[model samples]
Target: MEFNTKPDVVVIGELNVDIILNQIDAFPEIGKEILAQGMNITLGSSSAIFASNLCTLGSGVAFIGKIGKDSFASVVLESLNSKSVDTSHVIQSETVNTGATIVLNYDQDRAMVTYPGAMEDLRIEDIDFGFLSTARHLHFSSIFLQPGICEHLPELFSKAKSLGLTTSLDPQWDPAEKWEVDLSNLLPALDIFLPNKAEFLLLTGTSSMEEGIAMIKEIAPNLTLVIKDGSNGAYGWNYGKLVHQPAFLNTDVIDCIGAGDSFNAGFIHEFLKGSLLKKCLKTGALTGAVSTTRPGGTGAFDSVEGVSKIAAENFKMTL
Candidate 1:
């Protein structure tokens, strides 16, 4: 497979919209409704959020995902297109509808219910190695949401690596609570493994970060490991050393809906640029904090300039 095109990053995973209910009076009860003060239907899915914000961070990003031929699909496309992300590889499915997440936001906390429709249909066959070769890096997220991708991730990462592209994977919280990824085999092919403290602990089947770190080290000693600890910050490991980057404090957090995904976008954006690991981690924490400043996953990232503005005003840093 060959591709003459050049893109900094190619994101392959689920795509969906987040229907957020913010400032709710109370949590919903069965056969009952709760009135919310604010609401926003924005682009959802960790993969899409990462791709969109990564693009906003000045990366030439492209997305490869499946969506339905419906209005929600239009929202997905329009949202990505608005961010100037390449959507040439996004498939429009006829049978399945576009996936969606109903987000119930309660101040800093959130509960999400996802209906993965077309996203579930994205399989290894749908992935084109030639298309992947067009980019310098491959970042796939929400492995659990895309059962098709989850089933054959090792091969997918291997194929991307064979094409001379660096790769990263963020196995977002598994909805079924079955973190079933074969990390031992998968980590070797994955240049970067971005998982939060909880997800990492579960995936590695350990009680502590040190224990989980030891387990993965046995298989992938050279792997660039990053563990995102919400509020506590992020940690990055390379070789035998570990570096911790504290969370950029956000005093007025609206919600933590896609903070981890935003952190991933920040980390991977710097990573593709060949920045230092510590710098990437710091940027990730800052970006994650920026995500909390707004209502939805992408509110703080309306545009490249918008992200810069948020970074300057809110975080007292430049993007």
Candidate 2:
């Protein structure tokens, strides 16, 4: 694909491939092994899923991340290219291997172990401000998975803001359980901050959603805090008032992989189009439901028409 105009959004974060194993008989023990009835390998990473789905939703998307020169790298590139997400800014490293995640899925929940290879090598110095200045919005994800760039996130978001770009961050799970991010320095620079229910609690050091929201109000008063709460749907802070958007329930959920990232895609897509907060939240919930209808994250979002069809047929909503 060629771009004659600036991209609508530029995604800067980690990239990897997911090796998913589903329908496992039982959990694995130290001395025993388990069997999985289904398996698949696809593009895996919050940033990749968000970029691909957002591009499919009619936004011009560009990716800037690091990967290795290997088969998994090929899979990552091809997957993003298939979605027409510009990957020209993706750096290919000869030294490090591409990252990968081994996922053992059971119904709606799953456990994962990741090997952060090239993803860990991406740093603030690798970012090209010239290319970043071309986009109207900037989104970064999986802060814990990329230690090299983690501490520099504030600088990154600050620079993007200085260049007149709206910014969002989806700090995915902190595998170390020690959420070391300095939100005080970071949150002030972000236009939107996306975190799941548990992540929000942990990040805020609070036990309840009320406490978390209160902390955010004190810290980043102007920030748009979007919390993804599983089947209960999502919550967005509107003028300091918490508003709820219920999920579009799917009785036959294939899996819950990449649902949050899809939600971010939908929300950000509408947000860039200058839609209202309620519309963004609703579209996010609807897209999240669409993700579960298919096998993987990008499966249900094959095309714009297909996504609309899924919305109308499965969720009784016309997009």
The prediction achieving the highest TM-score against the true structure is 2
Q: Roughly what TM-score does model 1 have, to 2 decimal places?
A: 0.91
lDDT by residue (1-319, candidate 1, tens digit) is: 2224578899998998888888999888999977999988878888888888888888888889999999999899999988888888999998999999898978767898889999999999998788788789999898888887786988998999899999998988887897877887789888899999999998998999999998888999879999999899999999889999998789889878689989999998888778999899988998999999997687788877887788899878986
Best by lDDT: 2
Give the count of colliding residue pairs in each prediction.
Answer: 0, 0
Reference-based TM-score of each model: 0.91, 0.93
Query: lDDT (CA) for every model shown?
Result: 0.88, 0.93
| Candidate 1 deviant stretches above 4 angstroms | 1-5, 21-39, 104-112
In candidate 1, which residue pairs clash?
none
lDDT of 1: 0.88
